[model samples]
Target: MTREIENAAGIPVVQIATIVPIMLTVGANRIVPGVAIPHPTGSPELGKAGDKATRRELLLRAFKAMETEITYQTVFE
Candidate 1:
């Protein structure tokens, strides 16, 4: 059987999640999540180049999930 959320029907969509560094290391740096490479979200050092790039692009896409039309699984290898 498929999984189900409590209010899944009512909830449209929002946010994306990934395996973090593992994904990046596995050629999945393109996926978005609550955090990013080297440093996940909530890190105090969001001023570096890599950190900033991950934060801007990675983070932005995660937020974009909130406006997505439907709830679908987007898995990565």
Candidate 2:
């Protein structure tokens, strides 16, 4: 709903969700695949270093997604 509103208001929004498939089904145009439902940014079990890397990767993908143009729902892995 937030995404829809933002888009409607001419605000380009990037959605980060653990469930990429579901977001795609709901017609989200820009999405970043989250690490998990509980820890969408990083996983505690991955240790500090690994968790930081995962978070960095997601952030990079999100920035890339924002720069890229798309006609349909797109997910950055």
Index of the highest-lDDT prediction? 2
Off by over 4 Å in 1: 1-38, 41-47, 75-77
What C-alpha lDDT values do all the predictions have?
0.44, 0.82
TM-score against native, each model: 0.39, 0.83
Q: In model 2, state the lDDT of residue 21.
A: 80
lDDT of 1 by residue, 24-74 (tens): 454332335654334455344655775667556655665564444433443
Q: How many residue pairs clash (N, CA or C atoms closer than 3 angstroms) in each of the candidate models, in the order given?
A: 1, 0
On the 0 to 100 scale, the lDDT of residue 30 in model 1 is 31
True-structure RMSD for candidate 1: 7.4
Which predicted model would earn the best TM-score? Answer: 2
As for candidate 2, its clashing pairs are none
Those runs of model 2 whose alpha carbons end farther than 4 Å from true positions after fitting are none
Clashing pairs in 1: 14-66
